[model samples]
Target: MVTEYESALEVAERLNRLTPGEFEKRTGLFSTGAEAVENAVKIARTWTGRDAIVVLGHAYHGRTLLTMTMTGKNVPYKEGFGPFAPEVYRVPSPYPYRWAGAATTETGIAEEAFEQLVDQITTQVGTANVAAIIVEPVQGEGGFIVLPEGYMTKVAQFAKENGIVFIADEIQAGLARTGDLFAVDHEGVVPDIVLTAKALAAGMPLSAVTGRAEIMDSVRAGGLGGTYAGNPVACAAAIAALDVIVDEDLPGRARHIEEVVMPRLKELQAECAAIGDVRGRGAMLAMEFVVPGTRTPDPDAAKKVAAHANARGVLTLTAGTYSNVIRLLPPLVISDDLLEDALDVLAEATRTLA
Candidate 1:
């Protein structure tokens, strides 16, 4: 563990440099992503004078008691975890690929449907009682479901009009992993608050909630932090990670991964009846396995493919509430040859499963 004074100074310096805006003073560091999100909710509640923190369906914020309540999936993440936190509502995510209609214009349908849902939520949840609405710019554990075009902007407008603080959970999609410093940047939408971790420190335990000045300051100073809120080692790693991402142009590298992976995955979809959808942005992508020629999920097939990939020296993770989707989170530092090799392994796995 890092000494308290040393950690404080390191965090102070880093936050001063990275969050030049008013956030430098308002935002507090946390030992883990879960803690950061927990405090973000606390701050939002205090700022809005509201009761509940609204979450979207298939969202995976964290695993702490409060966060486990916000996660949309059940089974393993919540089976033994009883009685989660209260006032956290889950709504359907903007999943265009599996949306009810067969229209190729998914972005349009998604924009309309999800916005309508948001309107309904605010009405029922009572705008006056709604503290905040948290969502992943790119739904991570929910299957790397990138929102349809204009989806987030419309949602942000809805949240703003309803006086609900919009929180962008960028834990899995930020820090050049999605070909941008932040995934929310892609839509040109500036959320009221942003949550990030994962690759922020290249695998270290650190997360942050940077946001509007007043909202962040709503909580009392001592109410927002932890003993090791910003460990020196993790901060050092984060600073290094930021340098590597900028100097080596990891955002461009992420784009390269998407360009190569998406096309090949699309080919698999055309060839195999069991391949349902290929989606996501940059290096953060996923392909859902389905029952042959149908949208019905097939976790068994996904499991088989994952096992095959592991045997072949490639690692992959499964996601989505149904666990039938394969999510690819290759190290942004992986070589082009290695990236291609992994994709090749995945392609062959798909063929075998098909």
Candidate 2:
């Protein structure tokens, strides 16, 4: 029940410092990631005077109505939850591993796919009516999917060309989770608005939308806040957590996790035909499960592997539109020994499925 005077201003200042670019930045705090996302869209619409919002396929923005509508998956998030918010258009995400009939390369058909994505958005959702293009730099619940190289920059360019706000929904992949302060940093693409949460307050229920000051100021003051938005206690937690992330260099730790975990997962993939693809960046990685001889997704195998890991005291999450990806999201502060032990447990789980 602490008041805004206690810590909200401090949180805002700290968040502003972390946001990229030289333009004067402004931040608004919210109690949850969904709220942050909802407000970001509102701000974009208000500023652009437009009705359409563009979202990538296999993105998971949040669980609220508008956010759920933005999410690509339908079963658990949006099932029976329609009639949904309108003017929300979906576009292809440039998922490399699953690009049909395309050769697998470092860029994974991104150049070709990105051109098609641009065509779809222009034709389907007319740039003039688009308020924003919101995307998860790395798709979180949609199976830890990382966009192929150059894909993010291209999307940002498209948004800029059309006067649409580019919003990077970094709720799941931000704050050192992907070995960078913001996942968009990997592509060096500066977004017009950045939505952050999850690790922002170290799970203290704080989320923020930081963007260009001029754009953020478009929304009238009273239009943006809620009573509990940016609770003082939560703000205090976020301040402390942010200090820890920088002082401890959690981004470096995430990179170390990638070095340790990715090789092991690749090794396991080598031995198991069910492990179809090993993809993702930094510690935010996943292995998609498929039938032995084909690209056909095998959700059951993913379930079995996760169940086995759980039995061994290693909790795991399954994702993907097809529910066939075993996504790994280990804490940045976890010890090398504990992470290795968990990976060992996961290795055994994959072997059991094999």
Candidate 3:
């Protein structure tokens, strides 16, 4: 227990440095990303004295009952799950490829998306009755859907004006994975509660919820914890992983990855009719597969392409709400040669599927 406290303190100090302000920050460690997110909701509800939690379309938080309820997809993740937690509302994301059904300006999408979100919240769940607006700056399971420019800023402003806690679910796009310490950094939007996991402990089964000290303290001391939360071993691993991310400037590396991967995927899109969209940021990128000459999703193409790549020793994963997107989450420390080789395998796989 003494070691756990000490290690957690060290990890908290590291996280505070990355957070935007000098104000006191509170962090609660957990065993997985889902657990940490659930706790964030609990804190938001406790602090705001509300029950409704707002999430964006196609968002994937976790598989736990409450988090699953928060997820936007109905298949696979929530097929048979019954009686999910109530008061969770969803709004359309600024998905440029599918939202407006035509090419549009980023600024226009940002404004329109925000307006729709506000309208939904107002009509579906009153602001005073809402606890939090959870956002995945880059929707992990939603084809690495990066929020439109300025969209996040507007959402954060709305949350602040309406007294709703802005929760940034950075579980997948965080810790330098999106060319930023946090995805919201690109827009200079600081969330009230920031969730971290996946890479935080370098695969050591760790997750964290860091938020404003006051909001976090809203719950009684004994009200926010778990039996295995903040395990000493995981804390130590996180400290080391964080040190490496900073010392090596992993965010910069992610930018390099975006530079290398985006163009190649775009070129492939031009050549392969099934490649409908190439989007995402940093190492978190994806290509949404679609039927030729139309916008219909092509999950079969995505699956075949991923299988082709994996069979040849290059691992790839299929994602998105429709399972028509091949999401690429490469290791931040990957060598240039290895990345190029992986891309070659994917290119071959994509062409083969065609």
Highest TM-score among the candidates is held by which one?
Answer: 3
Instruction: Name the lDDT of candidate 1.
Output: 0.81
Off by over 4 Å in 1: 1-25, 101-104
Compared with the true structure, all predictions reach lDDT values of 0.81, 0.90, 0.91
Q: What is the TM-score of each candidate against the true structure?
A: 0.93, 0.97, 0.97
TM-score of 3: 0.97
User: Candidate 1 on 1-354: residue-level lDDT in tens?
Assistant: 234556545554554444323333444667777887898899889999998888877888889999989998897788889878988877667788776644457676676667656676767776678899888988888888888778788888888898898898888888788888778878888788877677777888887777887787777756766777777788788778778887898889999889888899999889888878888899998989899867889999889999999999999989988999999998888888888899899999989987
Best by lDDT: 3
* lDDT: worst 10-residue window of model 3: 98-107
Clashing residue pairs, candidate 1?
none
lDDT of 3 by residue, 157-192 (tens): 889998999999999999999999888898899899
Candidate 2 regions exceeding 4 Å error are 1-3, 101-103, 106-108
2 or 3, greater by lDDT: 3
For candidate 1, the clash count comes to 0
Clashes of each: 0, 0, 0
Q: Quote the RMSD, in angstroms, for model 2.
A: 1.6
RMSD, every candidate, angstroms: 2.5, 1.6, 1.3
